[model samples]
Target chain A: MKIIITVVGNDKVGIVAAVSQKLSELQVNIIDMSQTLMHGSFTMMLMGELNAEADFASIKKELSTVGEQIGVSIHVENQELFDAMQNI
Target chain B: METKQIRDTIAMIDEQHLDIRTITMGISLLDCIDSDSHKACEKIYDKITRCAENLVPVAEELENEYGVPIVNKRITVTPISLIAAAATDTDSYVEYAVTMERAAASLGVDLIGGFSALVQKGYQSGDRKLIASIPDALMATSRVCSSVNVGSTKTGINMDAVAEVGEMVKALADKSPLKCMNFVAFANAVEDNPFMAGGFHGVGEADCVINVGISGPGVVKRALEKVRGKSFDIVSETIKKTAFKVTRIGQLIGTQASERLNVPFGIVDLSLAPTPAPGDSVAEILEEIGLESVGAPGTTAGLAMLNDAVKKGGIMACEHVGGLSGAFIPVSEDAGMIKAAENGNLNIEKLEAMTAVCSVGLDMIAVPGKTTASTISAILADEAAIGVINNKTTAIRVIPVPGKDVGEEIDFGGLFGRAPIMRVNQSSPAAFIGRGGHIPAPIHSFKN
Candidate 1:
């Protein structure tokens, strides 16, 4: 199933690089992503699909550790709902 | 997929704020009924729980897959009063409300609606019980909302039911002021409005259905912002064009969903609705359409022009344009309006005057707690007069916040937003409201 990961935290170096590396390692393909800086805070919305052979739990744990290293929060939501929200 | 189109769509979505206004699943509980009220309540609870068990997960999946925000996943069941008609006492109604609240909590929904009674022409035995129990039902529950339809195009106005609602509003507000905030009295309340308290599963609906409410006030406002010095015609055209794009998106999504859910698609309600944000204001659209100010003398005429154009464009965009399909100017929900009200420009009277030409009436307005039931009824009467006279839909959602007076602010959190307490004429119109007979159908209502 596809998933959306919302990365919200301080504007800093290496956030995109770190998140991309983890997803790539887990074999998840990044379908689309956008980053915006609103009122001095960084927010990112990412759409990606899970790798068939990858373990969801392990990837989430790895993402969390990355989140802790950068003082950010990571949230993953199913993509069908994301699309429905956009469409509706 | 066409790579170029996909790239363009992604680019268009990149800079915008998009979120699901609501994902309302309509469930018909008629099949859950039996001769016994107790057994009927159990089946009703089970059926709602079972249908909504996976709604959250499925919604979350869709959210992640598309990178869009699914803000609310709610359910609108068959009106509880209809299913609980077999009850011998008011306790069954309360029991049903409690059961629905519990089921919603189990399903992780924020609110559950359809605690309704259709008493347009007159009240039935069950409708009376349901109406009388509204104060207790609303005060007792945390997430259940109640609505009553007291007038319609065909029935004109039901004075008895309307008077009863006035008292019900007072009792509900007194019980736990917030409960009163959840009650809505409507003239032509829609069956498939995805927006709150009044939405319900009409008899014409499927065993279950999904209706969508698409909002784009920010987009429309920004479009207007582009033409600051443009002529009134161009500004009106801009608003209509933007509304068309938004409605088209809703049409596409609604059709896909109805097809996927294996149910017929309902209407795409093109309400130029607003949130509490600074930029998302339907009133601002009126201002853009050449009104010197939103609550000024020319405001009604401006709204008439805007409302007519929106309908014209939206009707051409979709075959089914139902619900309260017009511009909504809920004062508390629109930041621009709240500011206007706080400044002495917008008041309850002017807002009601503007409703002469708009869609919903006197929405999200907060008056002083001391305002009597008669005055509230008077406001409802005045709005109903406009509706009956003009032959359109109108409604009242007033919150008499206890201990709060004019110029004070009451925060309702979330989508209900916050309202800056508006001034109510301390002078009572008790004499007018006491003349309790039906204001004979406005002469225009006799088109038959």
Candidate 2:
């Protein structure tokens, strides 16, 4: 299943590198990525595919830990929900 | 993958309180009927437990999978009056309620509906028995909800049933007045409603179906806040777009749940049901749409537009839409409404007027215990009249807290919330209600 991971916090270096590293560690492939700085605050949204072996809950916890280490707020959600709510 | 879409959806859930209100599995209990009451009760219990065994787990799984909060998991069986008609050993239908309660507890459902009777035209033996058992049944069970349809557009109002239910509501209040919260008096009640205490699997519905009720008053309110001071057309358009997003999520959840459970998908009830939590209020939506408060002069017009826009937006998102598809203004369940009522900005009379446009009528209202049963019946009649005249569904679920008077509050706790005992007009409608005969169907209903 595909999921969307969003990170929003102060602009800083290594935010994308850290998130992508965490995703690669879990064997989840980043399918899409977007990031921008708005009024000195950094916002990034990434759509990733979770392989069969990856546990969704653990990935969420580990990513939150990474977010804490980077001083950002991370949210993960199933991609289908966004498609359902926005496409129609 | 649009980042804006992802962020907006997240904001709707995390900030605006967007959630699927209920996923009710409607299980028809018609086949459980038996001549022997004990055997029938056993059959009823066994069938419900078996059919609903995985409802909670499946709903929770969907909640996690979809990343949307499914607030309630409930079961609505065929109206117990119809199922109890075949029982020969017992005249009282309280045991059926007990059986339903047991099934709900075993399955871990939040509430089990259909402890109900449809006596809109008249009463059968089972209907009478079930009506009589309502007070005791509701008082005894914690999770069982009940409803009675005492009027309809086609059949008019069954004044006799209305009169009886008035006394029944009072009796329910007399014994643990909070039990009155579990009972709904309806006019033109629908079968596919997933919201309790009005939900029931109509005899005409399929044996098993999954009906979903979607709630997003906060989302709508937030959208309106963006268009503040904008024209009505802009406001309406914003509401429609927001409702579309909300209902689409509901369709997704409902379809997935039905597929997983192997039950046919029922309709999605696009009701903007409110919660006691701030920012999750239908009345606040109205206020955002330029009303000073919910019960202010323009409230009805605001609610009417909101209700219509929601339906127009939701109809395109779901395959089927049923139940009371409009903004609900239950005082106790809505923080804005409760605040308005406490401050004397909203009252029962204005609420009665609002029901002509709102989805349901006089819902979750608390009245003084000293209020007479006849007065409660009169209130029901008034609300039913609005539904019948307008050809819409309206209902009453008022509680008359025992030994509590106006200005006092009854705390039901949790989702039921707290309600202040609002004053009821002391005028008597006993003469009209005492004349127990059917109120003839309106002229519009005669379009044959």
Candidate 3:
């Protein structure tokens, strides 16, 4: 029900707005988000709830297309799994 | 309640080879040792179990909250040899090892370090016994680790002890070569390194602590990959920049953890330590940094530059910088290092030379067990000599694998990995090792 979509790759204008529009269209509420420029590369973390009907695969596939269009790579993972990475 | 910008930063690191290497719980065992060895062992087991009980769940919770991967949750205790010193016989070592193993197993920790001795000058009876029992002690336990500091700058080198430990290591290797993977010998060794078999809680540490080792050879490599064919100065700049970001994350997390755990936060070791995994080799970073191949001529100089630059950058990034906080090049642990050794481009001698400039000495190297203890001692003496002279921390995790010769392989499985049996200088340096005494502190050590 909850997903974190990370959009990273080339620094460009409207990257955030574009992703936000996609989430708005999908009716996914953006719970939290943050972005920063590290080492001149643009990185972003977006936490949002995916509509229950929208499975992860479809969301990922759609984001992949959007990512390809923008010349950046995108990844979507479960919030639970994302949190586990911090344990190390 | 995540902000718009935080989400974006997380997206960039995905599938990009960022993960927390370990979440180690530092437990003080000083309260455990008793005049009676059996009682001491019991106290050790009980203390470790109680302190580490919440480690896994707490780490899991932190992992969830922070969105960073924590690969291991481990426990580090006061040096086992110190606690086991009350033993009248060898069983104390075994009993202590077994108890530590059982306690670690209960806490679900994969391995525990500090099954160790801190004999920089000469051996105490307990230290001697612990060294002698290492082979059987390690062979009998699954998760226990052992370390001994045969020499130190303040104490010079203890050649005789180094030689004997070498022989004992050979015997240990002979018993179960894999178990040899769990021991380390050191110079100016730290008490709070989370990575092992070299890591051990030192006499200087608090009752419960956490040390963070942040590694990013891949991140460094990726940064270098961008500036391929750049000048050495540019490469240095790129490395410093990348190290800053990597260390910032460690500093943030370490501070947060120290505050939450209510223990004094220790250091953030900014070593670019590598695993056997691909794209994670510190040596590869060198090659990427303009070396034709690792272990080539000038390799040590290159490493010295890299190691120094990392410390400079890291010290600037974090207030509490400790541990073996230079680039680590353990031969068996990094695939790139193993490849270098396999290709004959890297040898024990060159590795030792590199350690003088980097963090930790002769780590995870497998030497021929049959070699005279004197030779092993010589190796230890030589490494300690460097540390003492330079007044820097260095260590040796040499495994004289039994029955394995130069170029042969000894597989220890998992993170310990397989070491290509490296050659030892056949010449015996026993006469030198036999004359053991304190090597007084270096002039540099007087700067305090």
* Strongest candidate by lDDT: 2
Models 1 onward score TM values of 0.82, 0.97, 0.83
Model 2 misplaced regions, further than 4 Å: A52-54
Tens digits of per-residue lDDT for model 1, A1-88: 6766777789999999989998888788999888878568777777778867765556666777888888987766555433432342
Give the winner by lDDT: 1 or 3.
Answer: 3
> How does candidate 1 fare on TM-score?
0.82
Error of 1 at B34 (Å): 3.7
RMSD of 2: 1.4
B1-448 per-residue lDDT for model 2 (tens digits): 7777788898999999999999999999999989998899999999999988889999988887667899999999999999999888888888999999999999999999999999998888899999999988987799999999999999899999999999999888888888888999999999999999899999999999999999999999888888888899998888889989999999999999999999999999999999999899988888888778888999888888999999989999999999888888888999999899898989999999989987988999999988888898989999999999999999999998888888899988988788988989988998988998889999999988
Off by over 4 Å in 3: A1-4, A7-88, B1-16, B87-91, B437-448
DockQ scores for all predicted structures: 0.14, 0.74, 0.12
Residue B17 lDDT (model 3) = 53
What CA RMSD would you report for each candidate? 5.1, 1.4, 6.0
- Stretches of candidate 1 off by over 4 Å are A1-88, B1-16, B89-92, B259-264, B288-293, B312-319, B440-448
Best by DockQ: 2
TM-score of chain B of 3: 0.92
Clash count (model 2, backbone only):
0
